[model samples]
Target: MAMPVYNFGAGNPDPGSFPSQALAEATARVLEGAGETLVTYPDPKGHPPLREIAAERFKKNNGIDLPVDSIALTTGSMQAISLVCQAFLHPGDSIVTEEFSYSGSINCFRKFGVRMIGIPVDDEGMNVDALEEALKDLARRGEPLPKFIYTIATNQNPTGTMMPVSRREKLLSLAQSYGIPIVDDDCYADLLFGEPAPTSFYALDPDSVIYIGSFSKIMGPGMRLGFFAAKEETLAQVLYWKIDGGTNNFAAYVTAEYLKDHLWDHVREINGIVKGKLDTVVQQLDAQPDAFLGHSNPKGGLFIWVKLPEDVDPVRVLELATERNIRYGTGKAFDSQGRDVKYLRLAFGYASHRDFEEGLPLLADCVREARAITLEARV
Candidate 1:
């Protein structure tokens, strides 16, 4: 039988780690307690208990007191981004984003027909200086400042770099000075493996930041639970665009039931699981330095962004990877322009640990193959 591909495209939690029994129990409790509520439409703002609980948990974890009025539940954090962009972005309007970012959010913004201004991000996260420059350049050109700055501040997708506290402050200062709002995606913050990474941008400037969080990393994506906090005015507009009437009631209720006490424990266990995957994959890649460039040593998350050697074409690497039944996300996916980038998002989530031990070297081999193709093309 052919060796099945290692799927490293999704930043999903390990399926085996999902507390199926716990969730099952939670579901039973919800149905037995209030089965009728599930059939009724949930509040467009969100189910009240879920919102209240989320606000409490957020404050406990991040030191940000997002009141119930400021919060709105969504199908997933992905939907929160959509609601913001749909309500704020118009055709020809501009928004700033990390040079490397979440592909889903990028794609979602594009549908609004807004222009995306890419600001390059680094180890400590989005370069505030570059963001200032980008904003200034737009202002100088007489184009209106972007409607908002969209960012994945912690455990950034594709690139797992968290924005350091220093940069987060600078960023807030710059945005506030420019009167620009921020769409902060903090979905991956709870996945930290080591010391706590940093506080939410919303914590520093709650009024100016629309903060989104999710249970996908800590609980389960199938739960379809994510929520956001924003200023009253901004949140009202966001809810107006939330045409779903409400988020999934049963999923939200079950998650609310599951998280009454288990949030931190579940997240800690997943972090260790993800860390083991990261360790295995990194060890294999370390065997061939010249084959690839450096990767982010994620404190905790599903991905390590690997830069390919200069001569290696990412498309060629992908071509060879597909042949070998190895799947990975190219950095190109995260870009609005879809320009070629010499990088790959290798998700250690979802895929098996044994697959990591086996697939990574094959991935490195593909890198070498891609380099060969580049050399051949030049001849």
Candidate 2:
């Protein structure tokens, strides 16, 4: 059977909505001035000016108050996570993360043979009680404590749950008490739709938390640009893992120029558009509350995690939806434990309202069909 071509699967920004004109102009200007620098082996620590600019932006917008000496540019935030994980974690060390986490980060930890402990989450974000219990259990057994608590603090991926201000403080305090570091993934923090987002975890525990940011969600994914802010000592350790020979100088230059010009403003514009798309999807989901249960009402982010009834098979629905020209990320791809079969990660940022409205009915129908099939198999 021919599959439908709807692509709610991708988490990337809409191509038509990217600031191509501004980026093109900035890239051209940088290239003209870059001369031999673009061709030569770049600085191993990344372009200095770019790092400085990123540090300034973080301080201004996120209240991070970081110095250029505390920042390191990497190919992407994914690379930054990998480097940090490699630098700090030993083979048997365990890392604590949310029950639902960014799959890529989980995979990276797996590569290093590091154990991962999935802490439960609630409306306030990661459940502090659950984490405390886990910590206590590990301590009692004389097991090695987690090296760090990695979290998507703002506009968390998949679930789109942002940790509230009080929760942030509590989480930081817990980490401090345990003497473990916290890796705050703030990549989606800028996409906030509410009045004002809470300050990052790094701002709260500047000395212990490593802040990771990226231009992929704000600018474009292909830009391959990200930066991290940490304590000078931790950042120095991260630099020791820089096997990229040097940083991607051209990307850094382009990002620096773009920020100096209008990148932040452009982000606000994209946020506004994405907000509307999210609202439309939410409204659609609301209209059929029985079919889609346990989903997030995201203030701002690229994805909506929908929990369908247990009888609905996401893989079968994905297959059927694809046949009707609609697609979404099946729960299997995001589930670290291979047990979340009733969930689906739907991205609305890439599709227009008209497309969503047109395709949603087909998606609903696909779900119904999957539910029916499951019932039949049970019978």
Candidate 3:
């Protein structure tokens, strides 16, 4: 039997769903005028027009009050994160992040040989009590205080929990008292599914928080365009570290042109489609109450974290699901210790509900099979 190839593992959106027509039109306009400039090494900082458009969008969407000079265009949000890590961290410097965080960010810190301390999180996001304790513990040990606290404040990945406004304020206060900066990753903020999107942490603490945003989720990841906003001082410091020859000029040009021409309307339309598919997945999982122990109703973003019963080993289930043509990310991938794993991060933005609806039942069956196998092995 041929195994199915449903990839719920990656956070990528369906390529066909991207606004190809709109982007194509935008690219044509740029290419017509981008003559010798396209062949030359572009601005090291970024294309000025794109930075201006990004500044406007940031103010409109995130309520960040920043001039265009405060924004730096990067190849992707990943590159922005790397720049921050490199600029702020030294051999003995440390960072505080959520207990379960974006694996890519963790890998970046590892590359710098910086110490990472994972703060525990609850439904509201990173646990405030745990953060305070961690800070105090570091202080008592005579260890260097964390240079910055990195967070996915809104629509957090994996857990899909939005950090409450009060918690954001509290975190800012704690970091301020400790003289620590906050790196706010708002890549998924614009995808809010409901009314009253929370104000960004950058809006709350513009002076202390450096904000990173990406069009990958909005336009297409393949575009590899993202921006980081900070106070001029920090922006200048970070810009010095951008040794990518000339700042990603082509990406900036395409993104700037797209935004200036108001092509985000098409992007918003794609988001609507994603939201519907996300709702369908939630509804389907809701119907199978016995199989799904706990899950998040993501307000925005592409992923939902599902907790399964104790007997179900999500890693084994993921392997079994591969045999059946379905794929998922196991809890261990997001955890530090990678033990007692029973959670799965499911991405619903890329596939049709029909795909998930058909594959989910088989996924549930895989869980059952994994549990049975564990019991058999133990006996």
**Per-candidate RMSD, Å:** 1.4, 2.1, 2.0
Better of 1 and 3 by TM-score: 1
Model 2 regions more than 4 Å off: 1-4
- Candidate 3 lDDT, tens digit per residue, 201-249? 7788789989998878877778888889899899888888998776667
Per-model TM-score versus the true fold: 0.96, 0.94, 0.94
lDDT of 3 at 10: 72
* Superposed Cα deviation of residue 209, candidate 2 (Å): 1.1
By lDDT rank, best first, the candidates go: 1, 2, 3
Q: Candidate 1: give the clashing pairs.
A: none
Against the hidden true structure, what lDDT does model 2 obtain?
0.80
Per-residue C-alpha lDDT of model 1 across residues 128-229, encoded as one tens digit per residue: 899988888888999888889888878888788888888889889888999999899888877777888687888888889999988787777887889988
- Measured with C-alpha atoms, the lDDT of residue 281 in candidate 2 is 85
Error of 3 at 201 (Å): 2.0
Highest-TM-score candidate: 1
* Candidate with the larger lDDT of 1 and 2: 1
